[model samples]
Target: MVFGKVIVSLVSLLLLVGVVFGVVAAVRSRGGSDNKNDSVSSSMKSVTAICQPTEFRDACIKSLGPIAKNASATPKDYMLAAIQTTTEELKKSLEVAAKHNVNRETDPINHDGLEGCKELLKYAVEDLESAISMVSGSQVKDINDRVRELLNWLTAVYAYQSQCLDGLDKPEYKTPIQDGMVNATQLTSNALTLISGFADIFKSLNISVPDLKDLKPSTSRKLLEVNEMGHDNYPIWFPAADRKLLAAQSAGRVRPNAVVAKDGSGQYKTIAAALAAYPKNHKGRFIIYVKVGIYDEYITVTKNQVDVFIYGDGAGKTIITGQKNFAIMKIGTMQTATFAAVGKGFIAKSMTFRNTAGPEGHQAVALRIQSDMSAIFDCSIEGYQDTLYYQTYRQFYRNCVISGTVDFIFGSGTALIQNSLIIVRRPGKDQKFTAITADGKEKSNGINGVVLQNCKIVADRELFPVRFQIETYLGRPWKPLATTVVMQSELADFIRPEGYLQWDKVNRHENTCTYQEFANRGPGARTNRRVRWKNFKVLSPQEAQKYTAGRFLDGHLWLKYTGAPFTLGL
Candidate 1:
């Protein structure tokens, strides 16, 4: 019985050994011919090929080739690696820039410039890190938006690096910083190119992409219209049955609800008193005729007083002036306005809103409009700094003159300023830069923007010497998503070659800011030397049409009511 059991055990051991050998041979065969392994290898090769067409092909290969060698590396992985390399280069340049010490009081220009570059570079790094995180998340579902946003952030990185070089204008300190910035700029540009190429590759490989469409408001909000009839359509907002009553008041055919005069000839001696006497929520339009005089009172047309029309004899003859300023009043920027209009459908014609706090007062605002569908015609807004705040909502300004020292025409409103003169005044002794039109749109989907058409950009050389006009810029972004376009405008020689100024020492508005000029004439209108910001464009004639007064402000439907003349299209 013992011999029989040993024989059975030997047979069992042989069978186990045979089974192990068979399993090892099968695993080796599968490793050589697995479909998943072959697909991964092919993908890596494809990713490596993507780097060949970029300008910095050698840098791309050196930075991304090792990652591609890994069989599991995806297109996203390769992109992440390229971004990582560029970010590292930016960090190194920032380190070099930070070593240079500058005194704000002694070397203000260079000091501010260097400090600005450091802040920009740091923001660039944070933006790249966010981009990397986006790529690692589920991107396939919204790949188009993801790719576009990624490209914007990457383009901003390249632009910031260039700006860093431009800010270090001193030759002695520039060379060292330039070398590092150049490398970072090239690397980031290559990364942008590679990522841009991915869209085409995905299309070729039959990947799904979302349809690109204009996500902004297709139509503007239409206010109540007035036909020839004396009947009202929206009685809640306009209680009166006669729409012509408001039109007659606007045309001086009917008596004004209130008259403002410096002398005791009128019921109200001050404009503020006239505004206070004006009916609130009475509907229709309350007309106030401001007589020819300089009324030195700060006025506000409150929100409850909708459809208010205030007009004067002429721009210079009837002036509303104040001296409220940042330095003197110690108030917020918005509160410093000499005249503020916060009512819907507010209209002003043939008047001057002036802030007497000269350039040294910093952000003294002359006129601030926070109303929707408002119009200002044949008027003058004059101040030293931060004049004419077109704060929020849709507005129109025509046949007017806006003059200031810095950011003379600014705000976050969707404004179409046409047939107007934008005057850049001389800066104060401590001020170095003068910028006009600081649009502050804060979102991609926002309908807020500024479109300047048939306008003249001139310097007040009469107030400032020719030498003081050396640092004037057309505009600057006050927010990351700020957008402004100048079409068919006449620019003066005082405008800087860089065209637009940086917002301040540190802000990431450069990347997301949209600035363009089309059909602009004069020495400063030359586009060859404008700052090569990624989103700044010299729009084609076809592209410029969308920004015309008719299209941009939807003026065709509403402008006639304001009695303001406007060119329908470009």
Candidate 2:
């Protein structure tokens, strides 16, 4: 809705995360930046112009530097340099954190929070690595074509850093960590501002941009490879066994690596025991199958547990429930998750993760996932507030049921919820509003958001009768740039005509948050009475495509490998 001519610059800034310092360092080490166009005055003028529109203008200018030797650097080069420098800065600070390691942290809460911060930093680095790979591997001119992907990854890095700082809420440790993060955070702000100001920056600097062209994959890939393997099925990355297991009609046909049964009939009696039994240096999918039972425990699949696949009998049948919340627990909101997944390639199917914390429990979480390329299918995540923390990275929730009262679905993750049920439950006696989501996007162009595609939003049975008296909304912006899209979804009539809840009475988030609806139906989907926020809109087909599961998620590339069904486009 807010598309501007400077989209070129926005896309370019996104790729800066990993390349900023790396490119300059590479140029300085391997070859001097003595190109005809990269003159001292030109570089300075360009830096000034680019940094002018950035939030952290001083940091942007300082980071770009007065390097006299790099006379031929482009705005893109400076962007990359800034990003790589930021990454390095974060790394250096985290490296110092090694001395106050998780193993040595005395307080249990501090230990968990510190571990989360450290792991989040690693994820941020991973995101930066991806950005670097995208920029460094491809032709620089092709950057304009990968605008969405670049935005997606760059925003992920921002989310990672925010969560790290926010998660390290302990006052004793917060000050030092925040002081250490000053430079990196500032650079991040500058980079986000640069994303949409490319055209203006180039114009001011009088830089010549190459003619745009459609990107094409190498011909060798077409001839030598087929993205689909096993007769138009799994991707090449999916092993034969894994593919076979997924393709099987029934779970009975597939044998798992570990089985969890409450009756002690299986290899492990508890889900925690089964997870703890994970083999070291696990290569392929490590499967853990849980039988029907209510498991009352808090489980976290740590960063070291990669490629974990945990499936249960069914959503309600095999459940993991907990009662931790901000009201009753000393831990941070990040620590209140009943089941948290920190490993990559995490898949949870046919399971129920619930936080039994009542509405009074301010920030209870059912599930918190920081795993990249993760999928939750046929699952049920239910709670009153802060139910599902779709924290960061690329995530997908399909054919799942997520029920909550306020800000149930929240986080800074690039997430897509499709073919799912989002239930608006009854609030506590004093609670007046029911909010379904809170997309925690701090940066304007960062790709972290919640996209509800082909899903149903309905008030729960208990709440439906009283929906008229209570204010029920699709969501309110949790951060300045919070984003959520309801596309091709059904909204029950109980939903308030305004459609969205305002973060405050002043409409402070009116112009910043990106809230949109595309081809949504039902009485509640009527935009006639929807809030008239500047950033809210009824998206067109082209604009809606950007939020689809396929395009928004780039699911075509890796989702096939995971055997999760996904649509690529609207």
Candidate 3:
């Protein structure tokens, strides 16, 4: 058995070497064309021009110029060659990683890391192979589609190589496999850069390509125009009357329409009573001030209560608590929140919503929001699982503290959360991992996503045993097209290197989920070990801007009315 294993390893290594050498030889042999025509030299210059704009310019030119030396080589041929070269380099790196003796029994972390790298590299190879096949098959009729697909596949290959290295960056492991990964990453990055320059190449060759244009209104343009409308530089989305109301509230010049106190100090004691007493279908803002006390009642702001604002003394001082949970009450997840807001333009401030079901009672939601243009500020949502239910429509959360275990912040809404603290609680014995979000955007055209900007993700150390190991996942797609982006955040060490998780072992949503992270800092901000899902991206500054508060939720048009402070762009 040992001899057979040795033979298999040896054969694999030899096969990897042969594949690399074959491609290299094929490239080198075509270094100079036999013909001396001016047109042939011009085509060679086109290839050089294409490589010049790449990140690894010299390496790209050296590797691809020979492959493009054939006077008959088309843009598709050059792209295929670049992808083939990238896949070959990844295979070489994979072979090197396989040589390491990563035993799970002795060194579980490193072993898992190595095994994960192997899987990622294998996926990288497959991505590139698929790209090559697509280009060869002439399946894509549109030039724009072809270019986009090629760029996406090449980017995936580059990202996968980086992910492999990220998984290996641990104190417990030391291996020469990193050297191969470094080279492979650079090679794939160059390939991606070269592929991205295809438009320029096509332009130079006088090849017709589709006009690249963006039809959506620019966020910067909207910001500038919107700012012009407000004298105090407030968001243009807020109407002058609403702005006056906010100014009045800020100056303490406005009185509440109704007051609710647990004691008999007010006409209405419970929050539900206050809502019931307030006139229904009111177009103007109706303010309800709840005094300091734990209002142990389930509250619902129905659809008829429009533009309602609920304020409390403070988050911890004025609490709303319930014990309903899916496990104990046999309720559906959406119906399990202690507080449910179903109206439009609902705003809440300085209050705590709690589900007292504890960790054993799973899927206990503290707050459920389905209100369009709803905003929560200076609030605390505490529970074990499914804490804050962002059901649908648009919402914004600011300066809030949310503590939970699994899918703590979730829903199908297009929500923007800024400057909030996300606390991942220690799981119960039955739970193995914690997921911060489970977005359910099911359609490609739906402008529904969860964007967490400048937030902090921390673990609840007090809930765990001494030296207990904890792994937190950023999110998993509840629906195939689910989108979530965490940008400019600080992550605690408890966050796993993989960043996001598959929905399940069997019905994995890895390929279709749009999970991304950008410019986040901290020990868990590492991106290399993140899943190599087809749509997962480490976005550029330009791309990340699209998911900012102002852009993602169209905050410039609505957030100002809620009186929640937010940044206009990333």
TM-score of each: 0.60, 0.80, 0.60
lDDT of 1 by residue, 312-423 (tens): 9999999999988866555546667899987778999999999999988988999998776789999999998999888766689999999998887887667889899988
lDDT of 2 by residue, 1-570 (tens): 123222243344444423433444554446545666654453454456546777888888788775423866554565567667777877865765555654333565566677767867777776676676666666554344344455656677777777777766567776777777788777766766665445444554465444222223432222112343547365554666666666662445657889999998899989899999899987678889999999999999987898898999999999999989876665678889999998888999999999998898878999999887899999999999999999887899999999999899999988999999999899988788989988888876565788999999988899988888998889999888889999999999888898887787774686788899999999888999888898889999977877766556667566765656777677
Model 3: lDDT equals 0.72
Query: Tens digit of lDDT per residue, candidate 3, span 1-570?
Result: 000010111122223323333444455457644455534454455556556666676777767777666766544566666777777888899898778757666655456567767866786787678777765665322222243334434544554554465456464343477777765676676765554443444455464444212223323323223433567556564556567778887787867889998888977889998999868556568899999999999988886787889999999999999988766665545556899987778999999999988878898899988777899999999998999988766789999999999888988777888999998888777888889999876544345778899999887766545213656789988877789999999987778888898888886888888898999999989998988889989999978877876656657556766777778788
Best by TM-score: 2
Q: Count the clashes in each prediction.
A: 0, 12, 1
Quick one: best lDDT, which candidate? 2
Every model's Cα RMSD, please? 18.5, 6.3, 18.1
Q: Is candidate 1 or candidate 2 better by TM-score?
A: 2
Judged by whole-model lDDT over C-alpha atoms, candidate 2 comes out at 0.76
The 10-residue segment with the lowest total lDDT in model 3: 1-10
Candidate 3: stretches off by over 4 Å? 1-243, 464-468
Q: Give lDDT: candidate 3, residue 434.
A: 86
lDDT values for all models? 0.71, 0.76, 0.72
